[model samples]
Target: MNIRPSAAIRQNYNEIADMCRKTGEPVFLTKNGEGDLVVMDIGTYNRREKMLKLREELLAVEEDRMRGSKGYSVEEVTAMMRNAIREAEGHGTAE
Candidate 1:
């Protein structure tokens, strides 16, 4: 949800923004003119705007998992991961 305010709104932007955040609303601001120009509380606005992106990424990852995306089983994955750690720790090839 976004809101647009005239330039006058800037006089009390912080006050209005606090209210908006509390109410889960948004305020769009503009110069001393009509219609909206500047988006308000844009940090939250951007993050909320990316919600679909995040959800889509998660969904795609889940779909990949469902399609057997991994080349190794759990045990194999864990061992491979542990082996990598060991190799990194200067403990090459415990075998």
Candidate 2:
């Protein structure tokens, strides 16, 4: 984790922004010995948001499965995904 005093951010905003873009990670800013804010490039922030949403979806699916919900086998899921892709690509059918 890259952490720095809030004053450092105030003094070197451009440098910190460049670091976040290059590293794809947030820089933690602290004020009065406590975390104040996070700074990150937009693309990194979007990717992190996507990853967190995906994790939440997977957790929900796992919870449903644990509740004895029926689920597709790996091959069934793969074929369904392939069929969806084929339709999306204008191929009309997985067959």
lDDT of 2 by residue, 1-95 (tens): 99999998879999999999999999999999999999999999899899999999999999999999999999999999999999999999787
Q: Candidate 1, TM-score vs. the true structure?
A: 0.42
**TM-scores of all predicted structures:** 0.42, 0.74
Q: Which residues of candidate 2, in runs, are more than 4 Å off?
A: 74-95
Which stretches of candidate 1 lie above 4 Å from their native place?
A: 20-25, 28-53, 62-72, 80-95
The clash count of every prediction, one per candidate, is 2, 0
Report the lDDT tens digits of candidate 1 across residue range 38-58. Answer: 444666677787997899999
